[model samples]
Target: MTKDQKDNLFLLVKSLTKSEKRQFKLYVGRLGVNQDSKFLSVFNVLDKMKVYSESLILKSTDVKKQQLANVKAHLYKQILISLKLNPSHQNIRSQIREQLDFASILYHKGLYKQSLKILDKAKELAIVNEEKNLAFEIVELEKIIEAQYITRSISNRADYLTVQAKELSELNVITSKLSNLSLQLYSIILKTGYVKNEEESKAVTKYFNDRLPKLELSKLGFREKLWLYKAHLWYSFLMQDFLNCYKYALKWVDLFYDNPKMINLNPVFFLKGNNYLLEALYFIKNKPKFINKLDEFYTVVNQSDFPKGENIEALVFLYGNFHKINQYFIDGSFEEGLLLIPQIETELIQFNNKIDAHHKMIFYYKFASLHFGAGNNQECINYLDKIISNKSLSMREDLLCFSRVLNLVAHYEAGLDYHLETLLRSTYKFLIKMNDLHEVQKEMIKFIRGLQDIYPQDIKKEFRKLLEVLKQYEDHPFERRAFLYLDIISWLESKIENKPVGQIVKNKYLEFYA
Candidate 1:
């Protein structure tokens, strides 16, 4: 054999594996023996070579499979060079190789629709060549394309749920039930074999569990067990069971860690912060020895990547608690709590503006109390205006009334009689609007009765209107009215002689407060 012939045979032997080397020898014999005409024998040999090459490409695993298309393209180029050298092999080897190379490129580019079409062509060619394994591989690749399509669809839905959960939390309905339907849909997808295996199921399950707990999931129509899990967490928080709350909160965090993609979708840094805050509050109430753990609770909020600019509530809550701790220290040592007061007020103001009326009212009442305690009566009055102007009148009425009573007591202590009278008029207007005229009038009469003790001639006929309103409601369901009346009377009696209201009056006052 010529040196060039030996090199060509060696190249074919080196490129083809153990099985392909045997096939190549058969092809060489058929060509040399003229089993058919030279042209027909050469064409038959090239067709067998193409089958052997494609078989090797398909058998490669994922890492190697990624490079198979490039290898196939290089080999097809060589086959074209062979076809140009001898046009006799054209109709079989070169033509089939060109089509297969195009399909491989499309598959690699993620154009699965076009890739599948090209793959079908490749499968037809494999069938024609009687290569059963190559044909089966093409069929399997088609199934994979379908799976990728479904996975992308599911991932998009998960992204949407994350956005919705965040928006709902901002609305102060963190336990919103709208997430239940989505959770159910997610569960259905898991059961449909679309997730591929247990690992994927765990990935998706963890994602849903983390964010789903923050929403109103009760009316969501989930299975009994899922509802129970959610209810248990809520009840534990309500009961102030920090140990139980910590356990459930950690369960939620674990789900997110197990499936970090969840955080990528619905990042609830505030809710996570609240979980820690509640735990801190429980420790403060029940385990005072662990008060230092408050720093650890705030650490979680500081570490979260959630947008700080958007989470004003969490920031305010953190500052508020810090202020409380500062007050506790100052009161014990007779020092000033004013160092952090400006920061606390700034955060409170920002938080007040960000929330809706219902939440704003709650914040206003609390802020008013804080200012009143700090001896900033003007700030207290400003917060009082916010509370009264809040649109959720039904929710804020009782809170506003309580603040009014506190404000009047503060004004009386300061000897600001005009401010007391202004507050009295405001309280009268608020009670009329709330249709609790009898309670307001009873409180007014008791205020006048107390003034009578201080200055015997100060009791006037103007206070008679308050007594008349109370008389009209005398026969009504006065449980609430009677409690309010008794509250004012006890306050008057205590203030008149510098004596404490006894336990019975204290209980009656608490009943009215409730």
Candidate 2:
């Protein structure tokens, strides 16, 4: 049997909605010979099975082992065709492509005039939709038709197409370069988290500046500016410049609002831009703007006119749950945050394939944090254990390191002494191996390691001592990234003041607001 993840046919079958499934069946039934076809049998068998099983499929369907691959391939293509025919899946891009297809057929059948007419209309629509790549292709097609037919005013038409093609080509090249730079930077951040020190920052800055295209911001169109903002946003994130990240992310999101058609056309980018903006606000502790923007995001995404599809639904779920959890953290309502875990877990299962391992681990880290703030130490440990045990995750080494540090703190808070020394030694070695043993983690491990020697009466003093030490690093450019993962200062204050972590955070938030 093919591995479940690699079995695209089975995955597609399982991903289909009830309505989509019905549409596929009806589509298949439209052809009289396909009503009870072998592929239909294969689809029904595969859909009913919880997992992709070759043996079960052979037994349940008429397809033999030798023919199974071809059958499955046919079914996959048919399903995609059916989905393309679905109204929800049709958009401006699809409409333009359909016109191009019609023009191509007309051109082949010696209908040059009709083909040119269709190509002209398609090019206008593509340009209006900012589909420059397609527009360029349409221009090329028009040039080909005009070359053969020798249409009237051929001199002006040749010059017009030439200029349009050259300009579009230049703009597309710039968009491609910016998008490539943005993706590379984003990939680097995902694989290694933010740049760790000044050297790394300089390297990233150099790379960003070298690849970023030179262009006047005022002359760029919506698509060009969107990619430009994304490039800068990723660069800012890698540099740990949350203020600039906020600035570019806001520009990215606002560009869509300024051109409202793009909000629906490129909803995923709109959603991600807002998510990053909220993240930057969270980092800067701009509670009021964070709340306001988050509200706006939800309001826009929930609208009846908003784009809805499996991909969009998955992003909506991921971003919505993420910010919902962040809201609790901002408000210091950890107990209320705990209520979201069940729903998040449920959706996580439903969208397991759609959500990547790195993001799932992030949710686990947040889950552990919420439990820790709510004073559920054991629950925090349980969630942290998920991150610690996952050996395959290569992204976000920082998250891995902090999960262990947070795990150690949770065990201490839960009053586990017998294994404290064991955890301390292992965590120390792990941090050393990762080369991430910074002062904040160093002081934390040191304080926890000395806990056994300190008298019960001295515990508060130790907490106060650690609190004072971490406070200085809270503002340190490099060391402050640690606090972004776990609010150890607030945690220590909770211990020293004999209060819940959530209460300490809430008071801090209130103080910031005041």
Candidate 3:
């Protein structure tokens, strides 16, 4: 097996719950030969291991080096089959696919009547569940079966099936177009954090406008509406239009709420929609709305009918805690947020494989920001190092760029100025290479580099001057995104006032916004 496939097998094994592991063993042991099966033996060795090791497998099992790859491949397929049999994994979509498979088998046996009957029932279920793609397939299968026989209802049946096919094909086309637009927008954000200038903004706006389907909103189904809101959300995010982000994100979450069953069918979207809504609220500084919406999110998640399983469990923990920490940043109550770090860190380690590298790095950045706001400069630096030293470059460039910028700030605040110049030089060079050298970054770097020459009494004077320059761009078109990564304006005000940074932020919220 290739290295990625090998790691996938190991990760899959690690992801299984205790019951799932036991179920797999029972599934394999159903046959007497499986008790002493080579794959089972390999699985046993892997299950006992904390990490994958081919040498350890050879040392522990009777399986030879030459047969290891095949054995691992067999074990991987068998485990998935076992998982497929689990009741928790058998969702409505799987049920539809299963029925389609059965219908196909019956059709091959020339059981035309039986196949049509099954297809009819499956088609009804698919239509009722808004599974347009599957419904179209079921209709096509019905058409084929009908063509094989002469029936009393043949004339009526043929017309009905033809119309069904055309209608479903159209609905699927709309969904496909919307989903495609949403995905392309998401891909652009991952590659380039946001539009940096009018040219990029026009490109994104044109792309969105050109691809967006022009259907009456009232005529669209739940799925179509959901994707429409998501596309707009991403567009607003890229445009740095927080209020519009909030608007679409609210509509996204409301779509799920309005279609209560979709919440169960598509929990990932539900979780993400709420997260984005909260993120937008944070950007727009709407504390009251953010608090209310977050409460609503938890209420929905904590319900008895909410889906359960390892994957859902991991997602719930990740999104729930991410916004939980972000709330502190929103309010500048960093120390209170720090109280949850120990438990969150423990869970993060437990969920290390379940969560991806991007999310883990994001978590570290939030932790570092919390510590920085709480006046624990050294603790903040420790967390920042975790992000700075990471090797992966696939994360958003803006995220990576801000990690270094925040690191420079943390080091300077910690009285580690001896290291700041080298760090500042590296950060500037890194941003230039990333094509992310905005005015805010340049000004911040310029001020930090010139700090060594300024007299002690003149430091606050320079802070005031720097604050004036940054404030101008606090609402500037392309420059404001810098504040999103780090609230430089707030930090500067805190320094000028000689107060705790959190105090500065808390005062801002309570005074004007709150």
Q: Could you give me the TM-score of model 2 versus the true structure? A: 0.96
Judged by whole-model lDDT over C-alpha atoms, candidate 2 comes out at 0.91
lDDT of 1: 0.46
For model 2, the stretches where C-alpha displacement exceeds 4 angstroms are 2-6, 153-155
| TM-score, one value per model | 0.38, 0.96, 0.97
List all candidate RMSDs to the true structure: 26.3, 1.7, 1.8
Better model by TM-score: candidate 1 vs candidate 2 = 2
On lDDT, who's better, 1 or 3? 3
Q: Which 10 consecutive residues of model 3 have the lowest summed lDDT? A: 1-10
Which tens-of-lDDT digit does each residue in 270-371 have in candidate 1? 344334444434433333423443554455446665324334444547444543543333122112333445666586554543344554455555555545
For residues 181-211, what per-residue lDDT tens digits would candidate 3 score against the true structure? 9999999898889899888989999999999
Q: lDDT of all predictions, in order shown?
A: 0.46, 0.91, 0.89
- Indicate the residue-level lDDT of 511 in model 3: 87
